[model samples]
Target chain A: MKFHWFAEVTYGHTTAEEVKNNHTWVDAPATMHDPLKVGKTYQMFIRLMQLADRSNFDGLAVNEHHQTSFAMSPSPNLIAASVAGTTENAAILIIGDSLALYNPPTRIAEEMAYLDCLSEGRVIAGFVYGTPMDSTFCYGVPPVELRDRFREARELILKAWESPEPFAFNGKYNKLRYVNLWPRPVQKPRPPIWVPGSGSVETWDLVIDEDYCYGHLSFSGLRSAKPVVDGFWDYVDQRGGDTNPNRMAFTQICCVAETDEQAEKDYAEAVNYFYSRQNVNPAFAQPPGYRTVKSIAHDIEMRGASSLSNEDRMRAARGEMSFWEYDEKGYIIAGTPERVRQRIRELATDLRIGQLIPTLHMGNLSEELAAKNTQLFGTEVIPYLRDLWADQPDHWTPAVSQQRVNANMPQVAGVAGN
Target chain B: MPLTTQTVDDAQIRVWSAGSGSPLLFLHGFEQHPGDAPFLQRLAQSHSVYAPELPGYGESTGFESIHDIFDMAMRFRRLVEHLGTGPVDVIGHCLGGMIAGEFAATSPHLVRKLVLVDAWGLWIDADQPADPFVLNPEQLKQAKWHDVAAAERETSIAQSHPDGANAAMLLRQQNLGVATKFMWPIADRGLSRRLPYVSTPTLIVHGESDGLIPSAYADEFARLLPNAEVARISGAGHLPQVEREDAFITAVETFLAK
Candidate 1:
């Protein structure tokens, strides 16, 4: 199994009262945060990711969101560049740049190529149709046109990366007379592309058809994700698509410590802070045409049979659940190395997930605690889990970083290291 | 009133038609078509009223071919020609008002007279309009009617249909989704620039209390049109035709008579 160190880059200074009083996304008041503090937070993330690199995580994942204290990452490429230039072993997994938000998508082509060259081919390109709040509300792209714009941009970028010479391109959304990318990618046919989605069948078909790695990047834990992930695999298998576990990625919020009591003590408040601060106004969550009629029907049907009840989800989000309740329902995996390892192994084996993007840091977590969590998971947990899916070849991540991470992994007690 | 499917540009569209005299094309607002409303029935008494559900709206089939407002205008032109009508009077409301403005400007030869009621086609920076899509039911009620209590009587999307409530919701979503093509963010699709080119005599009617679109926009639309005048309906908000039916009908009929 491949592990990626990921975090939401949440602003750490927000108080519980402040979180309760306001919605955390799209129109969240900016006055609640200090710019200098945000800068310090960025520096803190860079440091934590650097530590993750040294500790032998396979990839460092970053993503883009807009107008949200929940993430605070507007341009993930900037963060990706910081990690790419600094880290030597981990893939700079930009879990993505919102393709439709960028005009003349050659900009994405050029930037991804620059990162690939900078990391010496340690870049994984991720293309996404950003959240409705980000694309339709914040960036002002019409929701109806978002998917079309993303597909056009993707086609343009791929052609720009592969075309040997400058070419004239005519597209409905963009028209460039001369299309040429100066800094071509280090990977022969550009970097491995990953597309993260929220269980839309259209997305499943897209990833399966294009052979791109599909990531179910929700922090709602295993119970929330199982139905959708299982449905995805079923859809893939029925279509006769590749059933390799390596093509799937899942996100989980994780907290690890010396003992289970220590884990609860250190992470409870922060986990509560994480869940409570993500109260998006329901109106902005799903705009018209954001999800198709078929997808909406499918979601309604799937959600009706889900293990996580509406009350459970609400309680989890409102931080009303106990720390163990959160863990029991799979909103998180928190405990000592042994318990975390057991739960994660069950999660990966049951879901058949090869790429696990573990969120080690969450809301209001201290820099020191997050670093320790990253260190513990990297040193103790990852080494033991490497053998779970070693037989399945992973073509999702860049080749050089995979080899480097495998070569540099630390030897665990009684287990043969990768 | 009768509902029929008409073939235009190799795509089928649902159209509602009734009455006699000269042809008049009635375009409904952003919500669903105010199906067989009293105002529509009254208008059909004096003029041959043809109200087609816009492509991709309701059961209409041609939304995929419409790339922009120009394409939408062309689709309307094809529909009009297929009806064997020459240069008909056009009345458009809300989102339909925006499309009607585009149609009048682009196909000046086809529209004899134009009426835009609580239209959305211009963006005035200082008097920015409220976003219609984001408003909740209560907020929308407050924004769309001068008398909030009267909003419960509004029948824009509540008309009885063969389909159940779930299908109705789906239809509502589908209609609003198509509206986002021109109305998302700000409703301005450079209609202010094209308004001057519209040779058809135009009447810019607005609800005095429209929170979705302020009265200043109607003034701006009149200011931009080559031949136009403004009529304000009191005790109304976004849907003046429903709020002050008699006044709206009088204003439209008087303007069309001229």
Candidate 2:
């Protein structure tokens, strides 16, 4: 299985008390953020990602959120641009640009192409209908029109990337007299596409029908994700889509150290900070018409099977979980590298996920420890997991990244003294 | 009156209509269409009240087919013409009030008189209306009524939707989703520009305690129309007709009579 270095890039300066006072993390007050601290945080993430690239990680995943201290990245492209020039390996995974948020979404095609060229053809284009808070509340997109806008944007971006000559395109949401990308992507047709969804069947159908990679992204860990992740595989099988595990990616929080006790000691406070700091207002979480009635019904049916209760989720969010309980709940895999690797192996196998995006640096983690975490996971955990999905081919990531990561794996192992 | 379906311009619309006298076309609010409410039943006693759920709302099929507020007004005109009643008196409340203003402005010959109650569509950035979309269920209840308990008395024909179990949820979303087209980012659709063209005698019935649109909008509506009067009903929020039916009826009927 491929291991990607991923983290929410949470603003580490805010405390749990401050978060509670701010009310909602997504629409938290502007005055709460110290611009200097935010700047340093961005720098820290970039430095950590660069280390991961040198340590043989396959991808550097960055995501987008708006008006939040939780994840300061409003645009993933800026972060991707930073690492693309500095890093020699790792696919610049923009997981991704919110399609509906961009006007005349050829802007996305242009930027992604620029990144691809900068990185020598290593870019994974992740198309997303952004969160209700990001798209509807922050950007003022009508929830009902969001999907339609995303669909139009996706079609436009794809067309702009592929079309050799300038073309006229008239769509419901966007109209372009000149449809041309100045720097087309280095990949022949386009970069590999990854679409992350939170149990929306429409999104599943979209990825499956187009044969793009499907990412079931959640912070709920194994227990919360089991129902949706398992349902996706079952649905893929039922629909006769390729059941190649490489096409499925899952995000997990991984805390690894020399020993199990050391891992807990290092990550406990940060783990609490990571889980507790983000409290989205219920209204912002669910805007009217964001999810279809059909999708809600599907959720009602699918979510009923999961053993994780709402109380468990609340306790987890409140940072009330003991370090061991968080591990038992699968919110984080905390232990020695051996233990983490074993747990992840079981997780990937059970979920049929070939791409594992392990969040290394969580909330309030020191830069030193984060770098250490990145190095350890990149060396110890990633090399061990390659044998798991060795038979299956991964078409989801850029080939340049794959080649670079594989070639550097032995060197990374040597650094680990293995 | 019973709920039924009507078609205009090949678009299916759910309609709630009753009573018989002078033809009175009632346009319900931005939310759900009021079913057999006391105000509607009272108005029906004196006039033939016809309330059609706006396109893209509950059981309404023309939402996709209609684009922009002008298109919506044109649909209203077509529906009125289809009714075979000439120059009916129009009463529009909240989001409906905004649409009624547009309909009266664009189709003056089709409308005899106009009534706008706690209307949206006029945007005063300085005194912007409370965001109806952002308000949660409890907040919405507080914003929409003088007494929270009155919400129980508020009626909707959509409650008996054909889609079983999740009908209330489905219809609420369907109706509000339609509202988001014109009222998403802001409630205004430039109806203020058209209100100046409406020469029809008008009444602006406002709930005194309307937190959603605020009473200032009622004054703005009155200020713009050629001949319009304002009636601020006491002990009511956004839905004056539901909260103060007698006062609402008296204000509207007096204006139409004049």
Candidate 3:
């Protein structure tokens, strides 16, 4: 099982001018080093990795974004490369390189291959179609076409990685006359592939069909994510696929300290920095046009799906809407190490998920606070979860392995086959 | 210098200013705080505009106790008196306009000229009910009981620049939580009557599609004031400064120039 600590590299500003006008945009370093260079941004990822290493975490995670102060790792592969050298043991997981956002999937495949080699086989690659508001506008791609393009991109990359030699393929988004990938991954076949989603039903089916790790990024709230995950499991059950709990993972914020009170106090500040400043941007979330039809439909379904009264919806929306304060019931967990462990166990059992990706370092959280939380979780919470569910063999594994293989797979002749 | 902040008792009150000219105090919308940015900087270039964080809004020191818009206006008047060294031109946006209107009505001697930008005052027929876009069901239900406090806020910045990036930033800066709390069924229906007592030169600029406080209401506001000029900024909403910044600015600049 691979464990990862996710960092968004978030910052809160009163206006965009503060970001655009500031000198730190160019002067600041992406990697953490000197205090004078602490860009509130690079500091976020640096803190995450440092904590991941200190806590014996399997990997440290970072992501990509454009034209926003959100987890500013525009080129996540760069951060992945930095993490490759920064930490020795922890696998550097780039929770995404938007395949659709990039013009050619080969760029992503080649980069992941290089990153796999760089990490010495410790690379967990994540693919995602861009979200509305950010990636859609940045790439100038119409939202309607994103899903088809994404699928085409994924197929191309998979062929590039798994195929023996250069091949040719044709699709709506890309056409390759010669398909050749250099420096194939260190791991046989390929490094573990994880697709991050926000409840796209089609994505769930695809993940299950391909036997790839399915990750649900519960950025909104746990209750909000129920229908989405339920949909994923339903698809798995329908296919008669052996449901490996480890096949499912959830990304949520978790902070643990010596005491519940201390954890709450420290977590509140970071939470405030996130909800109050960063995520509150209406532009960050307008309407879904970036993912597959199922994901977009799921989001649309949830628009009026929850039975919460309009007043409650408004409250929930307002509660979860800001970039300044903590959403008490949203995607975060803040408590003592013991309490955190129990909550994780309950969530895992209730959500029926196997692996858990906790975002411990978030929203301007200090290095000290992040490191302490990591260390405490490693020492206390992890053991408690393992001990509490000691009887369940299914709960024991890191990453669940599937026994079935795609037998009699067709040969990829050329662009015509795609 | 443009927008600046000063921490008062843990809360930070941001202030915006421009050229070392006559003071034109510009108060932002209901949920916003003053900050260093292009919008404030541009305003500062013409008149020495002073935009401050209202009590209980933004980073400003929140009200020590529960208070209404009138109570806030009283505090704002005090803040202006304390901050201004000489006669000043006063301006307000949305609820800020109401506060500025009330302030000018009450303390006519302190202000030389008054510019109310889509200010909220006077109980318009109540016939229209409230704007749906501004307040959702949660606010209406919660408003029934004063016990349930409104949520904390981060104001969404308005981006009017040609580049889509500013628009994108504007979307991110939106803090509906603050707006929910700052907004309430307004009281103080006497603003229309009090307008006759406002002795200062006044400019009333409004958006054509201001559903919350319609353009008709802006006209009525101007009609009541003995010394007033009324103008409509086309293709704008309640947030005319954002939707029609060029026209909004031109009206104010022309009024102030006169």
Candidate 4:
């Protein structure tokens, strides 16, 4: 199994009252956050990611969100550039660039290629149709045209990377006079493509048809993810597509310490802060045409008459759950390395997930505690889980980072080295 | 009054038509067609009314063919031509107002008189409009009506369809999705540039209490059109026809008579 380091760069210092009073996305008050603190936070993430590299993580993932204090990463490429320049062995995974937001899309083609070159071919390109709030509400791209724009941008970027000569291109959403990339990606054709979706069948078909990795990136943990993830695998299996675990990625918040008690003590408040601070105005959450009627129907069916009620979801988001309740619900995997390893193993095996993007730091987590959590998880939890899906080859992450992580990973005491 | 489906090229459109005299085309707001609401019925009393659900809204089809506002204008033009009524009086509310404005500007010969009610098409930097899509039920009620209780009594969604509340909710979502084509973002599709070209005598009917759009926009529209007048309906918000039906019909009739 491949492990990636990830976190939602949530602004620290936002109070519970602030979360209650205002939304965290689109129109969230900007004056609530301090600029100097934001800069320091960015530097802190870079420093922590560098630490993650030294501790034998296979990849470091970054993502894009706009006009939100929930995640301060408006431009994930800037952070990816920082990680790529500093980290020697980890794959710089941009989980992704919102394709429709960029004009010409050759800009994305150019930038991804530059990151790939900078990282010496260690980059994974992700194309996303950004959140409704980010794209339709904040960026003002009509929701009806968002998917069309994304498809056009993707086509343009791919052609730009592959075309040897300057070619004129005409697409419905984008028209380009010269379609050639100056610094083409080091990886032949392109870097490994990973498309993260919240269980849209169209996205599934695209990933399966193109043989790209598909990531179910959500903080909702196992119970909330199981139905959709199972639905995804069922769709893939029924279509006669590859069922290799390596092609699937899932996100889970990880809280680790020397003991289970210490884990809760260190992470309880931060985890609460992480979940509670994400206050999305209901109107901005789902704009018209953002999800097709078919997709919406499918989601309602897959969500099925289940135990996870709407009230549970609301309560969890409100930070009303106890830390142990949070862990029990699979929102967070909190405990000692031994317990965390056991839970993650079950989670990975149950969901058949090969790539785990474990969010180690969250809102208001002290830099010291985050470093320790990263260290413990890197040294203890990851080494034991390496045997999982080891039989299945992973083409999702760059081979260079995989090899480096494999070489540096401490050998399990009882298990034989590959 | 009867609801009929007409096929134009590859697309099918659902149109509500009634009465006979001068031809009048009624374009609905961002929501679904008001159906056989009292306001539409009242207008049909004096004039032949043709109210087609915009393409892609509800059962109407051919939304995929529309590329931009120009294509939308052409669709309406074809719909009017298909009606076989020579130039008609056009009344557009909210999103329909924007489309009606476009149609009048592009097909000057087809529109005899234009009425834009709480319409959207212009963007003023100093006085930006509130985003209709983002408002909650309470917030939307506040923005759309002078009296929330009266507006609730006038809501057409619950009474228009045979299906239950869930289906009504779904229909509302579908209608708004179609509205996003022209009204999403700022709702300004360069109509300010085209308004000057409209040759039809125009009436800008505004709900005085409309929280969705400010009264200043009526002046802006009047300033741009070649011949236009502004009429503010008292005790109304976004939907003047629903809130102050008698006053709205009188203003529209007076303008069409001219």
Candidate 5:
């Protein structure tokens, strides 16, 4: 399976005081963590890209979130552009711009198409309706209106990218007299798309129906996600759909060292810092619609259905339910080579996860620690996992390109299959 | 629309031709084919824009043919007739624009609208025009001769470096060398006398800051074409499309829309 490292590029220590101390620094929300300056972030991202390449990683991933301490990537497109210029042959994946946040979707289509040309067609477009809280309040998108807007934008972007020149599109979110993207991507029919979520009912349903890859960003852990994944499989089965385990991918906090004790000692503080920051901000911890009765009901049912321990629920309440908990039962996979490998293997087999995307830079972990984890994982865990999947033809492959995924576009618009 | 590629002797010619509108046959300058100009992409959204690959560009073949502007004009006339479309709107840029003016003079009936941009073949009085490709010490200082301050001037042309030499190569390789060689050249009779003879609407687009061809040439070119209207694009040098694309597009759109 393909492995990628995700980072929020959080400025571990830039506080409200720093902005207040300097008039030129500009005004910022006291509760938010802004991204590092363009030049520094660009330089840091380039270094990460080189490390990703050295690790035999298939892709370098970046994403978008705004007005919060959780993620500093407000313009993922800008980050994608930086990555595009630095890498010659790696997949530059932007989990993408929030479609609901953009107006015409043509802007997304045009920018994505331009990026594809710049990278010679090494772009994977990720379409998402961002978390209701972050997108709605920060971006001013009404939560009730976001889903339909997202669907319209996604359809409009797809048509604009794939259709012949001088085409006209009159979708709800966008209308154009004529449509054509200059310097079209090298690949025909455009690039692949990955939808990001934690097994949200709509997302899983669409993943199965469309056959697109689903990146279950289960930051909380395997126990919280087991029911969701199980629900996805059960839904597919109930719908009489073809079973494809390779469609699912999970992202979790992972760190590795020579020994479990050493790894925990090295990582615990940073992991604790990451959670502490979330606790202090609380905005990241309590997303809008997250505390609603309906949402709480779903979480409770999912937790009970998965048979998770009460400790996990209380931890979830304390905003520490993530796998990084020291109980060895959390979603986090940390420790010695053998210990971490065993945890990953358990999830890979029992959970049937096709790929494991690691967020090694959580809580602004030291660059040295992040790089060390990457090197160790690349040199150690990957080899072991490959061996386990060697004889299994049904296992998913790690490398993917957008051109390959965009080939099967929805030919008939507005028709739901499956 | 019909796309046909045929052998014009040893050279392969590619043409996108169709319909019974004003037959506008367009030719782009060096390193540029029909696609580089979105003028056609946008115009095609409306009128019948017939863009062909000028030899050695796009899909057209011929590393060496049409030695000068005169030769290119002759070959273009045959293309207009071969495509079986009528009274043409013959448009060209740089050396190609000079050839279109010559084509209008020689085969007056073939063209209905003659448009030229930063065209060559007209020599303005020793005004030290901007040669975006060459600085030659004197031109470098002269580039700063504008009314703007020296600091702002340096910032203005900072990105214009690296491309100065490439532009000079276009002059030496295509236009200058061939113009010096042929006696029956592209700029034969200045076409100034033929202005009244040619019954066609004309538009002469000149770059305001064109160093290769002075803005004065637009007036000269417009005065030479009887039915011509003149428009100047601001902040534009030799390649107006690159510097002021929106303005260049709007000018062309306004003229064509009329």
Candidate 6:
């Protein structure tokens, strides 16, 4: 399994009271956020990711969210530029740019290629339709046209990256008289693609058919994700699609310390803050046509009959779940490195997740604690898990960085899948 | 009134028709086809009423083939040419108003007179219309009507069609999902540019208290057209015909009579 250090880059100073007063996404109040603090927050993150690169993390992941105080990153490519320029080994995982929202669409190909050159070819291109709030409401791409726009953008970006000569390209959503890429990506064809989705059948079909990495990037842990993840694997197997676990990526929150008690003491308040501060208005969360009737029907078929109710989700988000309960429910993998390592091993094995994006920093966490968590997770937990999926080859990441990380990997004997 | 289906340009479009006299086309609003609402039934009494739920709306098909607002306008033109026995008087509401304007603009010969009720197509910079998509149900109800209680009297395609268990839900999704093509970012789709070409005399009706698209937008629409009139219905919101049907009818009938 590959270890990627990740964080949402939440505007760390937002208060739970402020979240209670307004939504955390879409039309979340801009007046409540401070620009100085936001810049400081980004600077702090760069330093932390720099540390993560040195600590032997195989990749560092960043994502895009718009008009939300909870997540200040509107452009993952800009953040990737900073990380790619400053860091050496970790893949600059942009999990991703909302494809449909871009004009000309070649902008993504140009920028990702630029980053690839800057980092000597360590970029993972994540194509996403974006969340309903980000794509439909903030960016104003119609929900019905989102998938089509994404499809056109995807085809355009890929062709722009690899096509040697300029060509006339016309699409339903985007039309270009001349298509050419100035600075092509260092990777031969293009950067590896990873697409994240929220259990949409169309997205599953897309990733499966294209053979791109599929990410179930939910903050909710195993208990909530089990059904959807299981459904994905079943669908893949049913379609005779590539069932390589390396093609599957999952995100989890990790809190590690010297001891179990110390871990709890260190992470409890931030954990509660992280889980509790996200308050989205039900209206903003879903709009008409955001999810298709077919996908909604599939969701009902899969989850309508399931055991978990709305209340369990509400409880988890409200910070009502005890720290231990959050752990027990798989919301977070916490405590000593041994415990976290053991839990992640079980999680990766059970879910068949080859790529693990352990979010080391979340809500209101001090920079100091996040650094310690990232370092500890990289050094103590990662080396042990290499033997789990070591047999399988990962095609999702750039070879150069993979080789770099492996070259410096700590040669620990007792920690191999024990 | 009987719900029927018609084929236009190889696409199946579900239509609702009733009454008889001169050919009159009724285009329903953004949220849905009003089905056999009292207002539509009233309109039917004066003329032959042919209200086709736009393609991809309700049991209507061919949404996948539509690429943009121009394709949408062309589809409406084709549908009108297929359905109308003679040049028709057109009444459009909300999202349907935007489509109806485009139809009249594209094929003026197919339209005699046009009525736009609380329509969307113009954007006012200082007094921007409230985003209809973002409003919650309660906010939507309030934005759509001066008196919230009036929503109970409104009927939708869901109420009219009971073919399957989840038919109502799915049909509504299809209807609104199709609407996003024109209304998603902003309701304006360069219709203002085409409005000048519509030589047919038009009437713009606005609910005085419409929170969604303020009466200022009606004024803007009137200014852009070749010949147009504005009627501000008092004590009404977005749907003037639904809120104050008697005045709405009186104003529309008087104008069309001229």
Question: What is the C-alpha local distance difference test score of candidate 3?
Answer: 0.62
Point out the higher-scoring one by DockQ: 2 or 5. 2
Q: If ranked by DockQ, best first, what sequence of candidates would result?
A: 1, 6, 4, 2, 3, 5
- What is the per-residue lDDT of model 1 for residues A239-276, given as tens digits with 9 covering 90 to 100? 99988988999999999999999999999999999888
For candidate 5, what is the DockQ-based docking class?
incorrect
What TM-score does structure 2 among the candidates reach? Answer: 0.96
Residue B225 local lDDT, model 2: 94
Scoring only the A-chain of each prediction against the true A-chain gives TM-scores of 0.98, 0.97, 0.80, 0.98, 0.82, 0.98
Q: In model 4 chain B, which range of ten residues has the least summed lDDT? A: B156-165
DockQ of candidate 4 is 0.64
- Name model 4 segments beyond 4 Å from true: A415-418, B152-165
Error of 3 at A275 (Å): 0.8
Candidate 6: the clashing residue pairs are: none
What's the TM-score of every candidate structure? Answer: 0.97, 0.96, 0.54, 0.96, 0.53, 0.96
Residue-level lDDT of model 5, residues A303-414, one tens digit each, is 6787667776556534464334543665578988777777888777777776577777766577788888877876676655653333434312213342232232123222
Q: lDDT (0-100) at residue B104 of candidate 1?
A: 91
For model 6, residues A1-418, the per-residue Cα lDDT tens digits are 8988899888777777888888989878788888999999999899999999999899999999999877889999989989899998999999999999999789999999999999999999999888988999889888988888898999999999988899889887688999988899999899999999989999999999999999999888887788889999999999999988999999999999998888889998988988898888786777778889888777767676444667877898999998888888889999988889899998998899999999999888999999999989999888888887888888999999999999988977886646
lDDT of 2 by residue, A82-169 (tens): 9988998899999999999998798899999999999999999999898888989889998888888899899999999998899999
In angstroms, give how far residue A84 of model 6 lies from its true place: 1.5
Best by TM-score: 1
Clashing pairs in 5: A2-A398, A191-A402, A192-A402, A323-A330, A323-A331, A323-A332, B130-B211, B133-B164
lDDT of each: 0.89, 0.88, 0.62, 0.89, 0.62, 0.88
lDDT by residue (B200-256, candidate 4, tens digit) is 899999999999999999999999998999999999999999989999999999888
Poorly placed runs, candidate 1 (over 4 Å)? A411-418, B156-165
